[model samples]
Target: MQIKDRINAFINLGKFLSEIDTESNPILNKAEAENGWFTQDNINFALNSWAKALSEENIKQWLSNYNLETTAQRSKIVAIIMAGNVPLVGFHDFLSVLITGNKALVKLSSNDKTLLPYLANHLISIEPKFKNLIEFTEGRLQNFDAVIATGSNNTARYFDYYFGKYPNIIRKNRNSVAVLTGNETEDELTKLANDIFRYFGLGCRNVSKIYIPENYNFEAFFKAMFSWKEIINNNKYINNYDYNKAVYLMDSFPLLDNEFMLLKEDNGFSSPISVVFYEKYTSLESLKKNLKESELHIQCIVSKAGIPNEVPFGKAQNPELWDYADGVDTVDFLLKLP
Candidate 1:
């Protein structure tokens, strides 16, 4: 199939997603029933984000960054081991493989078993050629030329041992962080709440940590976070909030609580659900050095502190097509495959 054929198939798929009534959609209902974390609002937000991204204009602009051959090339079967922490977490990798004219051997995450395959079947309907290019296997993946796997730091070691010989992109646990200068307006802080509470802080793109200036008061920050107070209504989220709070109290760990979320001072990046770890920074120069040394553990930075490559407030989860994860160019990896 031609590149245009693949692009057109995605564009059509985007239209289908955009037109659906997610509030009353049966598929979405089933997904939510299967995984309590996959709430209807969150799933709708994901679908909307993807629909906006797959526009012809957006696709063309993203492709402009690379030299793509128009005609079909020899296709490689790229095995994708997906992570299901959030809805459609593996869709980007799936898109990269197929859009680059490679066959995808996808292994779905048990937490997100239904959504992608349903969409894959739709893509096949849009461009029947995709029927041969897309696949899902419950058994061991075999005869694939390359691999792209996403998991925790532990699973990454296993992936390395098994797929080390192939050309691959294996991603491990990484968390996002925010740097606060304490000069941010209430509006900016409100937007920052979206980065914190979206998807109930499960996705890697969620801001699990923050660096604040010494003696900074959090009155305004907590006020802004009030916008997402309804998040506590979700049973799973509230359970985590209550449990983490009880454990911290029992252990004599000091914490700041606002009835919905907790903030604790720590030097860690991967915070637990309903808790955001924080560290007080003395200077931007020293903080920059620390972040540089720990770049491998960071997925993205959200700040207005003049940090290079920092994502703007509230936009961490709304990544564009070219915002490659872990700063790796997946399309480039697939294109150079032998």
Candidate 2:
């Protein structure tokens, strides 16, 4: 299909997704059954974000940032190994491959088996031409030229060994963080709660940890986060909270708890669900240096600290089309594929 047709198809797909009501939508109900993690609210959040991002204006603006003439030379089979951490986590890669006029050979993550296929079917229906461009695999992936794989750090090693021969973009585990200066208003902190609790903190974009200034009071921070107290009602999240809290108590690790979430002093970036790691920073210069040194493990930073390229509070999960994961330009990579 032509690029315009492909873009329009996705735009329509987004509209369709925006209309899905999990309480009454049959397709979403089926998806929820396939994976309990794909709850109505989480799935809707993901869909609505995509719908906003895939607008005709946004798509045109994103494409304007890249050269498209090179992508017209030939169509290659781009293999995509998707991740199931959040709903439609791998949709960006799939969209990138097709928007560049290439075929997609996708291996759906078993954790996210049903949703993409349902969306793919909708895409094909919108434009029959897409029927020839998209394919989902149940077994081994074959007849593909280049590959884009997203997995944990361990699986990344395996991917490097297996798909190493092909031109590839292999993504490993990464987490997002927030840097708080203790001057944030209640509104900003409340928004920050969305960054921390969205999707049950399973997405790479979720703020798994934060850096607070030395002597910062926790009262305002905890009070702002109280808006998300209902999260404790989620069985899966409560289980994780209880388990991690018990582990911390057993090990005599000092922790700050507000009954629903645990705040622990840690130097780590990746925190468990229902837990957010924190560190006290005495100086911005030192924090900047440390962040620069460990940049590879971070996906995005949320703060009003004026750090270069830092995503604003509460906006981490609502990334634009050009916010490619790992800072690797997917469209640029696809356009240059030989």
Best TM-score among the predictions, by candidate number: 1
* Local error of candidate 1 at residue 282 (angstroms): 0.8
Query: What TM-score would you give candidate 1 relative to the actual structure?
Result: 0.99
Superposed on all Cα atoms, the candidates' RMSDs to the truth, in angstroms, are: 0.9, 1.1
| Candidate 1 local lDDT, 137-243, one digit each (tens) | 99999999999999999999999999999999999999999999999999999999999999999999999999999999999999999999999999999999999
Total residue pair clashes for candidate 2: 0
- Candidate 1, lDDT over the whole model: 0.94
What do the candidate models score in CA lDDT, each in turn? 0.94, 0.91
